[model samples]
Target: MPLTVNEIARLLKVRGVSQYGREPVSQLEHALQCAHLAEQAGASTALTVAALLHDLGHLLAAERDNRADDDLSCDDLHQYIALPFLRGLLPDAVLEPIRLHVDAKRYLCHAEAGYWDNLSPASKRSLELQGGVFTAFEADQFLQLSFSNDALKLRRWDDLAKVPGLRTPPLAWYTDQLAQVALPDNQAVYQRLRMLLC
Candidate 1:
């Protein structure tokens, strides 16, 4: 079953206290900062929600194993892990960007001059794990996705969100935005069941 917003929130609250990979901030703090950046940029509600939940896969992974060891070689593939959990709950506008944000990083590394130099050490390590910089063909392909621009925007915010003590709106502040972009519970459940039966 797909998790409800409350369920996801509870999971985040429990698991997001771990360090965000090697970053100084916790996962929840990074998320809040990213969402704050997106909101400050005047993103749509869907994009804002996407920013808030983009790293949810990391939390889910930590739930399944100890994530405090500071190992960067595990290739958690976090970009893809949260999609099944969130598939029906959020619209494509939100989910697609979350799905592609990792690729967005790769895309930016190749497409933007000096972008790679600005990445944190942890992000640079993950970049190698995430296939390093994209080839020109790969960059072209990523840009073809419908939500590519949004993903890039989210990626930029992700890069800037690691400031350790940065103040941002609380997670509770985004609940309304989450609710606005989420699929109705019944509709989401029905969609999941239909997919299962198919």
Candidate 2:
């Protein structure tokens, strides 16, 4: 059976319920913030949905002794883990932005385009692992690739969505919203899921 809106909402609630905070926003809250930001900024429905679910790979990672907040430096684990989750559930348009958000940082550094000056300390460290300061040829190769703009936009929302006091919407919101956009085919399931969450 296709995952029902309620079922998906429950799953997200369970999967994303963070164990800490003032209001203690779930991962769902974070996703919603990103979606709202993108929509407010005039992004396509597709891009907004992609921004909402980009960090979903973290849900599928091997349960470690600690949560993401504990270290925020799991580069190798994230790259490998994101591939399978993205391959199975995400469409190409969504997957590309999710895949490239981090890469965009590295590419920006190589291009020396002044964008890197504002990245947080964490992002700068990740760029070092991705190959600090790309050579001229590498810069060309990175720029030649498409999706930079979308990835940058998504990254911005992804950064801005981390509000400390926001509360996650009631689960019903996800069910109701997703029901409006879900297609029958399984390939559209993630899109449906995203539609609801956004």
Worst 10 residues of 1 by lDDT: 62-71
Per-residue lDDT, model 1, residue 107, is 97
lDDT of 2 at 93: 66
* Model 1 TM: 0.91
User: Could you give candidate 1's per-residue lDDT for residues 6-66 as a string of tens digits?
Assistant: 8778876777777888889988899999999999999999999999999988888777676
> TM-score per candidate, in order?
0.91, 0.67
Give model 1's clash tally. Answer: 0
Instruction: Note the residue pairs that clash in candidate 1.
Output: none
Candidate 1, superposed: residue stretches over 4 Å from native: 185-198
